[model samples]
Target: MTNRTFMTVEEVAAELDVSKSYAYKIVKQLNEELKKLGYLTVAGRVNTNYFRKKVCYSEV
Candidate 1:
């Protein structure tokens, strides 16, 4: 494993090869999904494990 618990928008952009704005959009979507599940989320940041689990099953 990794030491990371969360990822910033910039890191998400690089990891997904997306623009920062797009990354923010993606992060927002992730956060929304989490909120639907009763998880609290922070703006501009996402849980790394949660991202992996969601992205792994999606087109990304």
Candidate 2:
């Protein structure tokens, strides 16, 4: 298992510079994708490493 943990919608909003509603939408979308892949998801939060990869693609 990885050390990566989950992030709240507030953290997602700050990280994406988006509104809370938008953050919820993003989380919901990610959660749906995870569900399709047979992974369990939590409400109002997302996996940190996955979130980073989704939004921080420019990092080295």
Top candidate on TM-score is 1
What pairs collide in candidate 2? none
Which regions in candidate 2 have their CA more than 4 angstroms from the true location?
A: 1-4, 58-60
lDDT by residue (1-60, candidate 2, tens digit) is 245589899988987799999999999999898899899999999988778777775342
Model 1 worst lDDT run, 10 consecutive residues? 51-60
Across 1-60, the per-residue lDDT of candidate 1 in tens digits comes to: 355878899989988899999999999999999899999899999988899888894443
TM-score of 1: 0.85
Query: After best superposition, candidate 1 residue 24: deviation in angstroms?
Result: 0.3
**Candidate 1, residue 8: lDDT:** 90
Q: Quote the lDDT for 17 in model 1.
A: 92
How high is the lDDT of residue 13 in model 2?
A: 93
How does each model score on lDDT? 0.87, 0.85
